[model samples]
Target: MSTTTTAPATGTAGLPLADRTSGLVGSVIDSSTSLLAKQTHDIVRFAMGSPAADAIPTAALAEVARTALGVDRADAFDYAATEGDLPLREALVDMLADTTDATALDRVTITSGGMQGLDLACKLFVDPGDVVAVESPTYTNGSATALSYQADLLEIPVDEHGMDVEDLRGQAERTGKTPTVIYTVPTFQNPSGASLSLDRRHRLLALAREWGAVVIDDDPYGMLRFAGDPVPSLHELAAGDPLVFSVRTFSKIIAPGLRVGWVDTDPSLQPLLISAKQAMDTCTNLPAQRLVEGFLRGGYLAEHLARTRTAYRERKEAMQEALTEHFGGMARWTDPDGGFFLWITFDSPENNTEIDAAIDTEALFEVALAHGVAYIPGNAFSPSRRFPDALRVCFATTPPARIHEGVARLRRAVDELAGAAV
Candidate 1:
């Protein structure tokens, strides 16, 4: 794990400074490990993972094919308007008509999915050496995007209430790091399932306004609420401004394959994002977009959400009950009102760290695999010892029996680890 070293080029201090550029050629080259990490193949995963639900309203799929092959029309052909098809765009506009009293269509931009929305945001704001604020633990994808851009990330610690506001302010004013944006997943957050307080939401917006830093509202799980009251979106609370944005996707509530997601940003930023969209893929998959367009437009979408929500609510209950019965005080976690995954904090004799601090090491993951269970570790979220003893488990993809079995497997793994120490 030792990294190779390359010393900085040195030139006569009295000589012209710009002449030293030639000596720096090999000094700043990208590392080989950076490339290999990107190429590393991951094992099959079921999260926080699940295949598309059975009730996808298949008639819409057939209709999409008909439209694509020109069986009924020729609209799917040619380079898509580079701004996405009008039908899908309008459908998105209609879908989010409920997003607020202040946000407008001119404020929305289409991208492949929430991931793309975030990538575009990072590309727009983060520059090498720029500071980016994130929840102490955050989505792995988002963190990677910032890091690849070489942005210096400052993590704002979190408690059960969500990201620490005071920590964020201190970082913003820190001498060395200059922050460009604040990224967050406020409701049913990934891996942590921590929801922000409404008061914190208002305070967060005000702080962003004061600091002139834009906030990226990554809320794919907001609508997945299973048992609690709703929190107003950052976009809704912040009013209209170039400084705040929200990224919403259909993946969770509908199907991940659709890749239809939009950003609620200032009107002035729309053209820039649309430009970024054109370069990414011109537009998202036409067939997928059309199928979702049909699905949402035909009016069966509401029923689809209700069906999934009810079933997922049951799964949530099972996860909670299983944790309480087994881990109990040994691990603490939020009973998410609604969302696909639950976050667990392991109370181990040793602190769970980014590497060996976690119980689910290479050995533990293998043990869980053999025991018919699997999960993503807490460190993977931010590569920090934020809570070395924490772990994330997903319940939405599996049925009741599988959920129970997975929890049992996790219990056995924990016991085995403790026994080895004894």
Candidate 2:
């Protein structure tokens, strides 16, 4: 008897996908990197929240790698502890000693990057149908991780002082549902670049305690502050509360390619995090951890941060100036003291009929790309698609001159779109 074989189904057509897979909403911010890489033109990148190429301490990292991952150090290539490499953990403890994010060894767990730390938080705290409150126009990647775990999201509004805690309270009351987890960037927030005010921070903690919610303090850019008074981190303000789960990364302050970050959780959760991490990645990349360890131990971070802070401050100013020069009549933007981005919202200038009455930034993105510039459409930042008239621009990656050029290109794109509409 000859048996005929059937070909297995490919893609999602006939395959059985998990119910949770539907929740795996990927990052548009990250996807932009690939999209820009495919282009051949000279485009000034203002999308990804990445450090400038010159801002990275390449020479210092190279020198550290010589000793940290020398040819003879074969063990550096092996698996690390599920919790983290001891040397690196110890270095982190020492590195954060004087900062607002200071923590002890038992509370720390190494992660693949800030993204993994976010994934781990959702994995541990969120369950199917659980409510997860996130900042409106939040870091979509973080919210995406929560979604991937089958959590229902509640978007809270964010203003210059960061997540409006009062709005959160009112929303919770109106919905009659308390969140299971509250996610915040807290300091130098991505896209908006706003920091949470001290009073709001305390109020948030109180509300989390009252609702029995876990606060995921995902602050990757806290250390990159270049202006204004340093506000206490949610982790610092928590004062050893187990409800606070802090996720930090070296990506912004250091090289993003290294893919190294850590979590400071309650010591009680360390074992659970280790078990969960082992089931996921086995361990964080050992080589990357070693490299970060060396970077911290060498006392290179302080100087590196200082230099990048100054550069970012200048770049932020340049972008603001360019925006004033070009879009001043029709757009308004946030003034963030630190971080990679500034959120821009378009509107009609009074007594000005030259520009379109309304600008859809999502429609304007492709036109901007064609004009040799790129930025994240505002809708991408909000899960609810609330900001069609806005967009996000990263002012950290380009130099002053290039920022001016990119802004000019963006203005041209807007004009081109307006002309087409007319």
Best by lDDT: 2
Displacement of residue 265 (Cα, Å) in model 2 is: 0.6
lDDT of 1 by residue, 111-188 (tens): 788888888898788877777888977776676666656667788887777888877877666755546888898888
Ten-residue segment with the worst summed lDDT in candidate 1?
A: 23-32
Give the count of colliding residue pairs in each prediction.
7, 0
Model 2 worst lDDT window (10 residues): 1-10
What is the TM-score of each predicted model, taking all chains together? 0.83, 0.96
RMSD of each: 7.0, 5.6
Model 2, runs deviating above 4 Å: 1-11, 348-354
Clashes of 2: 0
- Estimate the lDDT of model 1: 0.68
lDDT of 2 by residue, 1-422 (tens): 00111223334777787777777767788888889999998898998888999998999999999998999999999988899899999999999998999899999998999999999999999999999999998998988888889888899999999999999999989998789999999988887888999999999999999999999999998888889999999999999999999999999989899999999999999888988998899999999999999999999999999999999999999999999999877888999988899999887545344585578888888888999999998888777888888889999999999999999999899899998888
lDDT of all predictions, in order shown? 0.68, 0.89
Off by over 4 Å in 1: 1-46, 49-70, 100-102, 174-178, 350-363
